[model samples]
Target: MTWLLLAGAIVSEVTATLCLRTASRPGAHKGWRVLVGAGYAAAFAFLSLALDAGMPLGVAYGIWAACGVALTAVASRVLFGEPLTRVMALGIGLIAAGVLLIELGAAH
Candidate 1:
């Protein structure tokens, strides 16, 4: 259940951030603004549950940020026609590498 909550939090966090970005554009979507706020509220609530479930904060946050970066780039490209430039790809790769190192180092 905690894992589920954690995943939900991550998804909602990402959704909120994306929606916020969209909402900032001209002719903002009021619906998305509402979603952004709701999603963030849900995210924090679930994250609290996740912490209560004994998942390490470091691991949870690392996973959340890495997924957010990778998924958002992919989502923007596929869903919103945003360009996935080589630089963006490289930055994501670095984020992945850094997260991998963090996880690996924490295992000791």
Candidate 2:
């Protein structure tokens, strides 16, 4: 299903972003760099598949970007001890709401 493909795209994107953060750290292993590259490639490939499956560009991208941002922030907080400020959390919530609106509108 297209939704499944979209979910894969989102997860791959978030993983890729986290890998990028790890790759940027001091004394990071070279393997993280390879992971980042491969993750991004897989993310794009999955996203392309979702789009090809008749999902509208705006709806697909909005959901992908919003979910990626939210999930990445949470993952960073848990895995890398990054801060998750109230303002950032609120912004992520807003992104989710906006994506919901986009999806709802697309259904009509």
Cα-based lDDT for every prediction: 0.85, 0.93
lDDT of 2 by residue, 65-97 (tens): 899999999999999999999999999989889
Best-matching candidate per lDDT: 2
Best candidate (score: TM-score) = 2
Report how far residue 10 has shifted in candidate 1, in Å. 1.6
Q: RMSD (Cα, Å) of candidate 1?
A: 1.9
Give all TM-scores, in the order shown: 0.81, 0.95
lDDT of 1 by residue, 41-106 (tens): 998888888888987899778877787778888888887898999999998999889879877876
